[model samples]
Target: MNTKQKVKYKKNSKKKMNWITDHLFLFPTILFFLIFILYPILYNIMLSFKKMDVSNFMTGGVWAGLANYQAIFSDPLLYKALLNSFIFTFACIVIEFIIGFALALLFRQKFPGVNFMRGLILVVWMLPSVVVGVLYKWIMAGDSGVLNFVLTQVGLIEENILWVSSEQFALIAVTAANIWHGIPFYMIILLGGLSTLPRDLYEAAKIDGANGWKSFLKITLPLMKPTVLVLLMLGLINSFKVFDLIYVMTGGGPLDATTVIPYYAYKLSFLQFNFGEGGAVSGIMLILVIILAIVYLKLMQKEEAN
Candidate 1:
């Protein structure tokens, strides 16, 4: 080969080798995702369309073709699960956000023992959901619970209330526990966002005769929008997937009052050995979460464009 041709061939070979090496480095991560995430998702989607029970799961059961979906749609339990999931998710996020934002604002100011208090508050959030569930379950026990004892002593109520065992209070009890466990996460995230705000903006506002509330309304909220939106989306997804706490505390009892989507899916798949129906329920949840995720992405894109 001519000298120039040989040089070009060498360059092309080097480029090919580099490309191969780069892809080789990425292969492990790609393989992991395919095996762990993508495969399970596709498999579950397929399972949702099949008539699979514990006996037929290993044999690649009969193709029911939307029968599972039809059954799930017609089941009143599905609607109840959806409602509980929505109520739990909405209540947790709203209460957690409000309390967390307030805590963030409070901790933003310089004070003695503030760092210590913040760390202490985070200890609650750091605890495992199972542990929190057990702890609250004990505290909210009807006859001998601390909550009932305190309320009675304080004259709030003359009789012990069944917090976890009663349908009316089971959802509220779980939500309150979730809120306590979630608030520190929101507080830490909002505090980080607050730290990024320009101090000079506050100074300027103050010079313009803006009060604390006015400055917060005009500057803090606007500047924190992106952070707030992301946190809210994450909180929504996390809250919707809650299972361990409610399962530990209520076991979806008191007439399925606390049976959210995840728990319902678990009940169908594991408890009833109805994998097809369970897969259908899970598929529905995945679709709903994906829709929210798409909305979140669109909002982020719009914010970036602006």
Candidate 2:
């Protein structure tokens, strides 16, 4: 070969090797995504179209087309689960956001042991959901629970309210537990957003005679829009997937009052041995999450563009 041709060949070989190496670095992540995420999702989609019960689980299921989906839609339980999931998520988001924002504001001020107090609050969020569920289960016990004791002492209730056992209060009990566990997370996110605000804007607002509330309404809300949007989107998705706490605490009981979508799916698959129906419920949740995720991405892109 000519010298220039040989040099070109060497350069091409070098580029090829570099390309292979760079692509090789991504192989593990790609493999993990395919095996753990994509494969299960595809398999579940397939399973949702089958007629699978405990009787035929070992032998595999017959092709049922859209039967599973049809059954799920026809059942009133599905609608009830959806309603409970929405109510639980909505309550958590509202209560957690309001309290989280307030705490974020308070912690923003310079104070004694501020960092320690912040860290202490985070301990609640850091606990595993199962642990939090267990803790609340004990606290909400009707007989000798601390909560009932306190309420009785304070005259808030004439008797134990049966927080987790009664159909009337079971959903509220779980929701309150979830809210407590989630508050620190929202507080941290809002705190970080608050930290990024320009101090000069508040000072500028002061010159215009803007009070604390007025300055917050004018300056803080507008600037924090993106952060708030992202936080709420994430909170919604996470709340929808809440099964561990419900399982550990209520087990979707009190006549299914706390049976949100995730736990409902679990009941169909594990308890009833109706795998096809369970997969259909899961598919519904997957669609909801995918829609939320798409919205989140679109909002992020818009924020970046602006």
Candidate 3:
């Protein structure tokens, strides 16, 4: 070959090699994403359109063509589950944010044992969801529960309250436990955000006669908006997908009072052996989470632009 042609051939070969090497490095991650995430999502979507029970799950199930969606949409239990999920998510996020913000503020002050206490607060968050659920279950139990004993001794209650087993209180019980487990997470995130604030702003505010509350409203919140938005989105997603804790605590029991979407999907899939309906529930949840994620991304982009 001519010299120029040979040089061009060498450059093309080098480009090809570089491309191959780059892709080779990415192959493992791509493979895992496809296998563990994408494949299951696509499979579940397919299953949601089919009529599948335990017997037909192994084979390709018969296509029912939106029957699963229709069934779930028409079911009153589905509505109940949706409502419960909304309530649980709302309560968890609001309460956790408030308590966490307060705790973050408290820990922001320099004091003796503050670091130790901050580390200790993470114990609740570090515990496994199932462990937290089981622990709370015992603590909230009716007959010999610590909560009941304490409340009664303090003259707050005349009788032992069935926290987990009572239909009226089962959702609240699960929510309370979830709130306790989730508070540390919020505290950590908010505290990190709070630490990044400019100390000079507070000093300036003080000099300008802006009181604590006024400074917090005008400076702290506005500066922390992005962090707060991110935390709210994350907390919403996490709260919506709560299953292990609720299952361990109440099993969505006491007449389905705490039957949030995840647990409902679990009950349909495993307990009732109805994979199609369960898949439909999961697909709906997936869509909701995706929408929330998109909103979060958009908000983050807007924040970055600002």
Maximum-TM-score candidate? 2
> Could you give the candidate ranking by TM-score, starting with the highest?
2, 1, 3
Give the alpha carbon lDDT tens digit for every residue of 1-306 in model 1.
999999999999999999999999999999999999999999999999999997887898899999999999999999999999999999999999999999999999999999999999999988999999999999999998999999999999999999999999999999999999999999999999999999999999999999999999999999999999999999999999999999999999889999999999999999999999999999999999999999999999999999
Q: Under the 3 Å rule for N, CA and C atoms, how many clashes does model 1 have?
A: 0
Name the better of 1 and 2 by TM-score: 2
Candidate 3, which segments miss by more than 4 Å at Cα?
1-18
Instruction: Estimate every model's Cα lDDT from 0 to 1.
Output: 0.96, 0.95, 0.96
User: Considering only N, C-alpha and C atoms within 3 Å, which residue pairs clash in candidate 2?
Assistant: none
lDDT of 2 at 128: 99
Worst 10 residues of 1 by lDDT: 53-62
List, residue by residue over 137-199, the lDDT tens digit for candidate 2.
Answer: 999998988999999999999988899999999999999999999999999999999999999
Winner on TM-score between 2 and 3 is 2
Error of 1 at 202 (Å): 0.1
Mark the regions of model 2 whose C-alpha exceeds 4 Å error after superposition.
301-306
